[model samples]
Target: MALWGGLGQAATVAQLVGADVGGLISNIIQAAATARQNKKECEQLARRVLMIADLLPHLQDPEVMRRPEVRRPLTGIDDTLREAHELVTSCQGKSAAYQFVMAGRLADRFRDVQSRIDSYLLVFPFISHIDITRRLDRIYNILLSNDTAGPSSSAGSQLDVLVSQEVLVHRHGVGKFTLKELVVATNNFAQEIGRGSFGRVHKGVLPDGREVAVKSLGKASSQHGWQGLLRELDVVSCLRHKHIVHLVGCCVVRQKKSLLSFWRKNVEKQEELLLVYEYMKNGSLHDHLHGPSSSSSPSPVMASWKMRIEILLGVSRAIEYLHDYAGVIHRDIKLSNILVDSSWVPRLTDFGVVVNWDEA
Candidate 1:
């Protein structure tokens, strides 16, 4: 059978209401109750499905439902709910080994369903115009909360689990580095190469004798900074391309310290986030275009029309890859963010603010 079977047909509100949405919702709830693994994710999906079910009544008005905007999102929700039902049901009565093996895939499926449902809710017109706005907001907040908690938290330990277990093992071959290893590699942060809004960059030599540029998140002690670091890691770890900066590995360390109080002594800890990438010997495009020289002129390479065109084409290809294949937008695109290797191949770096196109 086709996935999202009903999506091939034009769906009317009456047909959707009279059809299997209610049945699908009920099945999802029952399946979630018996889920052996990913139970919390299943339950969250069920709640969001029920909330969407409540909005169906508001969408049933003949005039409002006739509009393509309203009908299309409703149809999408219907299809998504069916998928959710199937996903939850599959988790029931499975053997421990089966569940363990499928845990990561199941989690990814749940996250995809939740994201789709959230998107439909945002685009569904009646929710915003009617009395359901507050309910919609609650559902939206629940989705956001689920997204940022547990495996998605900015805490060093949680991020470590996400990067090492989920990302490193499955998607890319990015490794996890220790603080001591990084300190030794960078000579205790001795050679500063560059700096950006998030942190400073340093030149380092890996134990393998490969050169790398290390970006340290200077403000990771604060909540916002930690979140930004998490965002960058999450985006960059999954991407692999010739024109994109390669993520060699990452380091997340929690450093402990003791504090003296008037009454007693206390202990505290802070996390440090760092990303390692292949070193670009030629530096950033901004430096070639604007950095000072004895002759007060741009670099010979930058002054060449042929070289500039080649650089532009390389950058364009990278952006195209990010949009068409990777489904992400590089929100930060600038001369300084684009680095070149000795071969003059441009590498797009900095993804702290990158967002999925759907979310954008």
Candidate 2:
């Protein structure tokens, strides 16, 4: 088999190995297409194996493939694909009686291959963060295409919600919240927490009882404000890190209303954009340093030399991560933008003015 044939090869020749493995996976997929027994299971296995095949090209970098983390999963995928091929090929050209006798066993084999492929793919390290972001954008586009196909059924809506929650929250580290949902969470925007160039922040509680800070875009009507909102979303959605402020999700509300006037007046449509973030209960580093909290009876926690050092280190690491791993440059890094969580861990925020290093 191709799997065993490629073993014991030099790590530096990973590109060649990846190509060979990909070709084997293609053959397996082709074999699965002709499967008579366990047709559904065979198709499922093919789909899972294809996902691995899609990732193989990205692993062609010799240095990346040499890493144990990457190499082990690639090897596991190879072995699983080999077994999958054998399982699928066995089901082809089988007599009905033979298929019936071995149906359960074949089904188990397919399930095992599917499970192994999924586990291996789960551990596959993303070689490029930009590529990951692009993939996520493609997923979001697919969702949008489905939504615009036609009027949605309840079942379809439920599926879309499930997909959005799973793919957006778990994979992309973000969520999509509706305006009505935000209204209920924020008590109709009753509590004002802070303000920024883009919008006003309101304190809110999510349906799951988690506190959040909702920034309602004040400049949605202006071209500059609209661009800022898009820029912030573009930059923040792709970032996932410990010391970075987690973007819970965003809400975009569009409404059409007619303007009745003596002069020429038509329907006006506007989008209300809001970004939700994890609530920083301890507030900003600026608040602790120069605000009322830093007065005569200052917060002892912020006053601690060790705590301050840790906070500084956390903020520095966040900046370093942005520059190195994410290829981002946060142009507006100020004390006020450095939020502190309940544990006093500093989180870097306000990416509205951030730029890609390439662009910078």
Best candidate per TM-score, number? 2
- Each candidate's TM vs. the true structure? 0.51, 0.55
Error of 1 at 250 (Å): 0.6
lDDT of each model, Cα atoms only?
0.71, 0.70
Residue-by-residue lDDT tens digits, candidate 2, 1-360: 333233323233335345356556778879988887778888888777666655555554565456665555456455667788888888888899999898788777777877778787776555444345555565555545654574345645454455444444555566788888999999999999887667788999998999999987774356456556656866788888999999888875533211111012221334466889999998988888877643567775556999989988999999999999999899988899999998888998887777888898
**Local lDDT at 289 for model 1:** 81
> In candidate 1, which residue pairs clash?
none
**Model 1 per-residue lDDT tens digits across residues 19-91:** 4665676677778888887788888997777665655555554655555655565565667878998898887
| Cα error, candidate 2, residue 70 (Å) | 18
> Measured by C-alpha RMSD in angstroms, how accurate is candidate 1?
16.4
